[model samples]
Target: MKKTTILDLVSRKLAPFMLLFGLYLLSYGHMSPGGGFQGGVVIASGVILLFVAQGVGTTASLFPFRTLSLVEAAAFLLLLAAGLAGLAAGAGFLGNPMAGVDVRAVPRVSMILVYNVLIGLKVGAGISFVCMYLFREGR
Candidate 1:
């Protein structure tokens, strides 16, 4: 595929906003409709856009495969740790650890927020890695 100067420039300009939007979705997900999966897909779409506009080699250099794999692994482990912490706290697996806490002291949605962030990181890294691999294989 031939890369165009205009496509590359536009993608570079737009990618940051896509990332910011994804973060917004993850942060406010507890109060709104968007959540981990959706936000993560959005983030991955930005990277994929770069892959298409800038070529696989350039994009891969910016987002290395090793780094993406490690990030995905770490996010998954943290999610599991969160679930275990909840179980240890007697809230059941994947339940809110702060369920009994006063809402004023700490919002009841804190756990949901944490879960959203972790899941977003995991999904984003995993999808980006897979797409990067596919793009390379096509070469």
Candidate 2:
């Protein structure tokens, strides 16, 4: 059983581009529309494109289950640690501690950007890993 077609090729070719778009959305999230969660799903869809174009095996090779799991876990822990840092700084849990920081130097927006990137990577890797794992099970 396989999925080999012009459409699959097109998807395979477009998957990286889709991933770039998703990253763009995540990077610009603080300034414009879309954010970590949305971008993360988009990135996961890009990974899905590989599965649909090739197969579970090929996709898994590109993104090993163990590596993906590690990345996902690291991203989650980083996000949690960032929030905890904010709380420890006396800004309350998940609060925007950057607000009180030296805006003229660091700028509060940087915190949001970092958070967005962390969340995006966490969610993207987690979702993609889950999908890949399930698809592998199916095979």
Candidate 3:
């Protein structure tokens, strides 16, 4: 009946640190080795830990399937929109379109960071949802 065991306690304590690390990876992906997909999986693993430690029902309550879907959709749209922005700027897709412009806000570094964050959030939610559903189906 009790889900709050020592393992759960440890997971709870450790999850935040894992999440922070994942965010760090996403933010610093361009500068470092890791990137969006990697950080996303890390974050998803943290969520999966919570799901296992707290049980599917509890995890679902905190991060519902519908919410995950929304996050994924939003992230995807934003990522696409980002590419579309480059196209609109007449630099094709993902190319430096704003080079002739101010080059302050739409710089390459900032775009990469934004892309990484979006991709990280999207993949994290997608993988976590997959894990939860699989566990629910007894697979």
Candidate 4:
């Protein structure tokens, strides 16, 4: 059966907030229970809600697979580069390096925050792409 107007409306209305909350989760993951993977899944769930109600064609117009693929790759590379930076700093891969840096506001290169965001982006895009493909195939 086709989706109802209420479903469409609710999905659209709530998705932005869900996305925002997912970001919040990513940001505060170091201090709280949730983290990158959870936030990424949350963001994808919002998008998937729209996809389920609106169809892949419509969702694809807004979030094309190519764009998400690029995002996924870029996020991975960024995460990798961050890891390499830690290694170059004489720390282990993905190690925190700014704990003793003299700079006050250079972010101390908060690895937790950075990794959470990168992981969130990668996972969100990966999951979205999979769903898009499945939807396209009518699976």
lDDT of each: 0.90, 0.87, 0.86, 0.86
Clashes of 2: 0
Q: Write the per-residue lDDT of candidate 3 for residues 1-139, one digit (tens) a residue.
A: 4665698789989988988899889999999988999999999998898887878888788889899989988999999998888899988897665665786546657878878999999999899889988877345
Query: Which numbered prediction scores highest in TM-score against the true structure?
Result: 1
Worst 10 residues of 1 by lDDT: 99-108
Model 1 RMSD vs true structure: 1.7
Candidate 2 regions exceeding 4 Å error are 137-139
> Whose TM-score is higher: candidate 1's or candidate 4's?
1
Q: Sort by TM-score, best first: what order?
A: 1, 4, 2, 3
Clashes of each: 0, 0, 0, 0
Name the 10 consecutive residues with the lowest summed lDDT in model 2: 130-139
Error of 1 at 2 (Å): 1.3
Model 4 lDDT on a 0 to 1 scale: 0.86
C-alpha lDDT of residue 124 in model 2: 93
- Model 4 worst lDDT window (10 residues): 100-109
Full candidate order by lDDT, most accurate first: 1, 2, 4, 3
Local accuracy of candidate 1 as per-residue lDDT tens digits, 1-139: 8777888789999998998999999888889989998999999998898888887789888998899999999999999999999999899999887886667877888899999999999999999999988888445
